[model samples]
Target chain A: MNAIEIKNLVKTYKGGVKALKGVDLCVAQGDFFALLGANGAGKTTLIGILTGLVNKTGGQVKIFGNDIDVDFEGAKKSIGVVPQEFNFHMFERVQDIVVNQAGYFGIDDSIAVRDSEGILKRVGLWEKRRAIARTLSGGMKRRLMIARGLIHHPRMLILDEPTAGVDVELRHGMWEYLRHINAQGTTILLTTHYLEEVEQMCRNCAIIKEGEIVLLDNVRHLLTRMPQDTYRVTLKERISLEKAQAFNAVKVDDHTLDIEIKKREELNEVILRLAQSGFVITDFHPKGNRLEKLFLEIVSK
Target chain B: MKREYYIALKTILRKETTRILRIWTQTLLPPLITQTLYFVIFGKFIGSQVRSINGIGYMAFIVPGLVMMAVISSAYGNVVASFYGAKFQRNIEEILVSPTPDWVVITGYVLGGIVRGVLVGVLVFAVSLCFAHPMVTHAWAVVLFTLLSSILFSLAALINGIFARNFDEVAFFQNFILTPLIYLGGVFYSIHSLPKVWQEISLYNPLVYMVNGFRYGFFGFSDVDPGVCLLILLGLTVVLTCINLFLFKKGIGLKN
Candidate 1:
């Protein structure tokens, strides 16, 4: 039972801007899927089509086996989307926004109240439930969107840039909440620029480029495919350019060097060469995240 | 599934009603003050000098028309502002992405307009009672005409909101089209008082039938045939509703 299946999806905007050429992808039931793409790679358009916000030029979309064209309501009922933009009413109170969303799903008043409270509390917005939505901070607003998107207990949740503006602390909290819900069997389709988030949360990953899925595989498998890792090394003192050039390290500055290491290369060999050359390593870190490295590798290819 | 639409309708109704009440100063107060001014200036100050038109007290003659005008504006304004506000803020996507049907969304917004229109109409009518001893010759006719007129304007406003891209577009329809039609619809003076040439032109305005039909319900007298007026109103309501539904189905100016 796939949570979502899109086949040959096409979308050409009004002025002939081809947003999606022919995107095909699938997210297994209860899987946390990460959809990574560049700015104009049609990630938002794909999510818009799935949520019925954008009319597709061609292709088929199914949610939990219900075809969108054949059973529009059924397909819609199975999914909830948190769009990239803040689309909820700004004048309404935080509680009404979530409760009203539940109402649209045919949840009764009592249940709506209970669920709204539960979700609001989970999102740490219970205390501010009576406040107008616009008065809340940016992170709180993002959490409110999450609460509203989950009020109906959708089988699949699509979040587009959900943590774009969130701080590190709040982002971690939101990630925990998302993991909790996903653990409870809600399939989450997350689109994010934060590759670290995808590494931390998503099990299966798909990278879309130019409106098409160019890579789709398990997160670990994709990371394992990377043949080399780049690291930024800080030295105690500046080494001669010739000494660094012998190891083919790029001198970033007087005391810093950028080094690339193959997966099977011995770290001691590189460090020993620097050591023998009178260079003492002070600090070292990967230049980029593993997923990010792979993402850049695949997209650039 | 059977309960889905009903629940959505109820939720939307509650939200819209809350919205209407939340901003009472903006939504309700302006119409009350505006209509009251009309009664005092047009019905008392100028109406005294004019005496009576069509053998009825001038104040009483304009009461139905004034109330009808309020109904049209309030109903139309409520839906137009509310729906366009939804569009402007992009919050309409909440319902657009849900399982709620398009008809349910239309009905919810139309009913919101109707509620505001009817409430304003009744309030104006109550205010009219202080100025003129207006009597309802057919209570059912008054209710029927008021409901029909509200529905008509509500649907019209929905159409306007759907086509409107910005606040200026919404105001353009109201000021250029709606306000002018209402004025020429014979709110202050009876069309019969005008020269036969202008009277002939007035007949082309659909609002004349709505105003006359409502006036007929109050005094059992009308400038046009009340039966014809009712049929015309019914026909227009059907047409506007069909057009609105078609727009929603096509997602015009809504989905992209």
Candidate 2:
């Protein structure tokens, strides 16, 4: 069975603001599925529904084939959520926050306390265990949230923009920790605006726009589906726009021309034509698929 | 079903008690100070001129009313502020998503409010001893009435917290509705001393019955039967508790 399944999910706020129109998604167990979208794109809304934070307007959600509404307790036990906002009690210490979360899952104090220490240490927060949550920095607080979410050893972990506002080093560190956990048989569902993070971490990807799923496929396959390839040709001499236009290329500047080639063979043909025109090609390279392009393509359509 | 509910209830109650204990200065001190002033200004200075009320000295007569007044306000204020603070900080989502049931959440917060209320009431009672010789004529009745009244107000506060959109909304209900009811509910004088029309109207206020019953426990005297007061308090608790639980289940203010 899939780890998490959402079908025909819909959410509309009180003011008739339809945040989620209809979103259908399926994530297999042990898959690091990244749900990519811009701000206000319903990624958080979807997480909220799955975690039971937001009530669904209409639809069905299941965890391991157990209906969310009918078997909510069982579904909740399998899912852990680290929300975008820092939501821990300000007065609660790091250790207490983690252990209390375990207690909420019906785990006794002895086991909860032991697991709390281990999880806090795993997230590099053990030394600061007694510090109040409000005293932690933004990055450290995010790590604390991760530790609290994992205290119960849930089967699935859902992270919403976990790396936002985090330094690159810490972001990478979080990715490594999350990867280790994912490798240990915990399915991960991540929603992040950072395209590079998605590219580096996710095996499968889904992009949502305006409350609807625009694309859902393997990350590698999605990257290959770019309609246009951008190639930068660095000329030995500044070429005139008139001359560059003759070869059906857009002159980005006097020395650089961004050319669109239909096929690999067309690349050599363009270079030969440029050479025949007495224009020396200093460097030539094709730009790989990027999230900016993917986002524009999906949102614009 | 029973086991889960029991566990959730126990945890919530424990957490609430801990919160009050952790912040006794804020939760337990203000009311003790206020009651002291009330005893000095009203019981000592003002009661010197006024005759005995309802066959009891003015100072002893108003003791139960003052105690009930403290319990009601503190009980309501504790839950409204604590629960709404959780909402404001977005920490309520932790419990909202947990395996705990909706009623369990409601009961837990209500129980917290009751603890604060009873604690404040105890503090005020201790302070009142300095002004007048207030005796508990029936220990069981005093305990019963105190617990019941605290629960009633606590449930009301939970409902207020759930429906409140901001801190202003939380304060609005307490400042306007709760405070007025507490002061007008025969805290300073017996309702019988009021005009005939006002006496009939005071019966509509729920706090009046609570004060009268609480006074009955203190002095073995009351304008109304103690059984009637108990029934009214229990009824209010059941009705408000059901409303709070329903609001929680529907995710009324929290989900939005």
Candidate 1, residues A1-301, lDDT tens digits: the string is: 7998999999999999989988888899999999999899999999998998999999998989999899989998888889888989999999999999988888898899998999999999999999999999999999999999999999999999999988999999999999999999999999999999999999998999988899999998888788988889999997667766787788888888888889899888888888887888999888879889778877898
Candidate 2: stretches off by over 4 Å: A227-289, B1-7
Best-performing candidate as measured by TM-score: 1
Q: Give candidate 1's whole-model lDDT.
A: 0.92
List ranges where model 1 is wrong by over 4 Å: A235-238, A253-255, A268-282
User: Looking at model 2 chain A, which ten-residue stretch has the lowest summed lDDT?
Assistant: A260-269
Instruction: State model 2's lDDT.
Output: 0.86
> Which pairs of residues have clashing backbones in candidate 2?
none
Question: What TM-score would chain B receive for each of the candidates shown?
Answer: 0.97, 0.96
B16 in model 2: Cα distance from truth in Å?
Answer: 2.5
Per-residue alpha-carbon lDDT of candidate 2 for residues B1-256, written as tens digits (9 for 90 to 100): 5655665577677767878888888888888888889999999999888999757899988899999999988888889888998889988888877777787787788788888888888888888888888888988888898889888888888888888888899989988999888888999998888999998888989999999899988989887788998899889888998888788778888885
Chain A, model 2: TM: 0.85
Candidate 1: RMSD to truth: 1.8
Q: A196-275, model 2: which lDDT tens digit per residue?
A: 88878899989899899998989878776766677889998988989888977889888998887763445678788889
